[model samples]
Target: MKFNRQKREEIITSKKKETWGQEIKRNWQLYLMLALPFIYIVVFKYYPMVGAQIAFRKYVPAFGIWGSKWVGLYQFERMFSHPIFWKALKNTITLSTYTLLLSIPIPIVLAICFEYARGKFFRKSVQMSAFLPHFLSTVILVSLINLLFDNRTGVFIHIIQNIFGAKVNVLGDAKFFRHLYVWSGIWQGAGWSSILYISALSGVDTQIHEAAIIDGANKWRRIWHIDLPSIRPTIAIMTIMSMGSILSVGFDKTYMMQNPINYDYSEVLATLEFSMGTAGSVPDYSFAAAIGLAVSVVSFVMVMITNKISKTLSDNSLW
Candidate 1:
């Protein structure tokens, strides 16, 4: 068109700005959709972070958040020196590790099994049955466990007594607490947790399987090569998420299942925090806050490290 250089540049800039304006208009709904979650994070998660300062202070309820006296890391120092804090930390770590070891692979295995099931009916039934426990309230679940394992007259105890003539107290013994807690957690959650993996697996292309079949690939070969690859990223992401929660062993289950005899093994950070906050004549808010902060920091670091390792090993990372 033999336009002047200045005029040409102006037209190009105008066109680029128009394109950007159109993009903003097109994606405006997405930004709007994200607004609520953004607000929620700020309101619920980030906002409460201001209270983390109490971890380093002699947090006085009367003085309020800002008016509280700062003790620097004195609370943290006390937490480190406290034997019960170490015990709770050790117990928390032990139980979390046990639960993770028992629970993390379960959903993957269940997903694979369900994927390979012979019929839709069987798969659906299995999935429904497995997922049903997750619907139960923790109180109800604990009640059911107690009913089934009641030392004198419970079903499991009866069976053990009949077979081995040994009356085992499942809830009363320190040794059995971790096993019972972790295994029950796995049983309650594994099936429901598999739902995500199953959904991810469902998204895998059927055409890939058809191609593998045409190439005379066996069922195992197709699954090993195709199915696993399809869900690898999902597994990686879930594993990273799971690592982040390794210190957050559920308080309800442990607290409900615990008794005086089993308290040594069953005490975890959450339970300790609860007891420290509520059991005494006066609540030790600062101490509890310090412990909570420590747990959160450790969990966050673990997740970051796990995500880094996953990124290094695979092509996927949560970041």
Candidate 2:
């Protein structure tokens, strides 16, 4: 009787194991669902990476990508030697740093505050207003910015000029570029970004909150010990993801906001590459490719380093 039971258990265990092909056949619907996105990524995303080899070549329109002369690191050398490269790098880093400082904390705070909002009506109304801006196209948003911050006819400038007897060209002034960029970004993104933290907060145990309340813990104390910690992992993951794009600040917005006066502060890597590739007398694809590749490399390194630090410090990371 013991031998017969052992044989039966062995047969069940063997039957439970599945090969890769067998699993796919068994759950064909799930694999079918995944196929569309997999093909889209390969075709639209990975396939284009093949052209990145142009960074090493002196691409000529007549010669084509493959027939172009392999100039090796010459494009990189030229890009680094150009004064605009360093200028753009400095502006990009400064702008992105300001954005990171505000973008990371503001959403978290917004989420926390809204979670404990006193009234559902007020909370939903304010959240909808905040989120509406995010749906606006970059061009429309920039156009609105230009209208509102115009040096002469702008509503804001008119108010300031009347109140202080001084004119402020918010868009034209290089000094105000970072301020406008970061603040506008907060306005557009904060509400939408807060949704992740809100989701995290929802999963926190209600029983624990009840116990904390019974023990005489105040709202602030409960939040400090409970809500904040509950969303800490989500915050860490978001930070790691943000680091991946730290160097690639929004191209369309930055380019649109730029004017001759503010070019010094607004010329980020994306715009720089764009101008190099298209704005010049003859498009320098190789140089532009080199700049983009460098930005990508640095951003990737930053992400890895941030993930390592987060893993070490809080045991929460993207990995």
Give the TM-scores of the predictions, in the order they appear. 0.87, 0.89
Report clashes for each candidate as comma-separated counts.
0, 0
Estimate the Cα RMSD of every predicted model relative to the unseen true structure.
5.1, 3.8
- Return the lDDT, model 1, position 120: 94
Give candidate 2 misplaced runs (Cα > 4 Å): 1-36
* lDDT (Cα, 0-100) at 227 in candidate 1: 95
Task: Residues 1-319, candidate 1: write the lDDT tens digits.
Answer: 5578889999779777787668778789998999999999999999779778989899778898789999999999998898898888889999999888877789998998999899999889999999999999999988988889988768999999889998888767779878888888888999999999999989999999999999999999988999999999999999999998888888888889888888899888998888877777779988988888988998999999999999999978987
Give candidate 1's whole-model lDDT.
Answer: 0.88
Best TM-score among the predictions, by candidate number = 2
The window of 10 residues in a row where model 1 has the poorest summed lDDT is 15-24
Candidate 1 off by > 4 Å: 1-40
- Report lDDT (CA) for all predictions: 0.88, 0.90
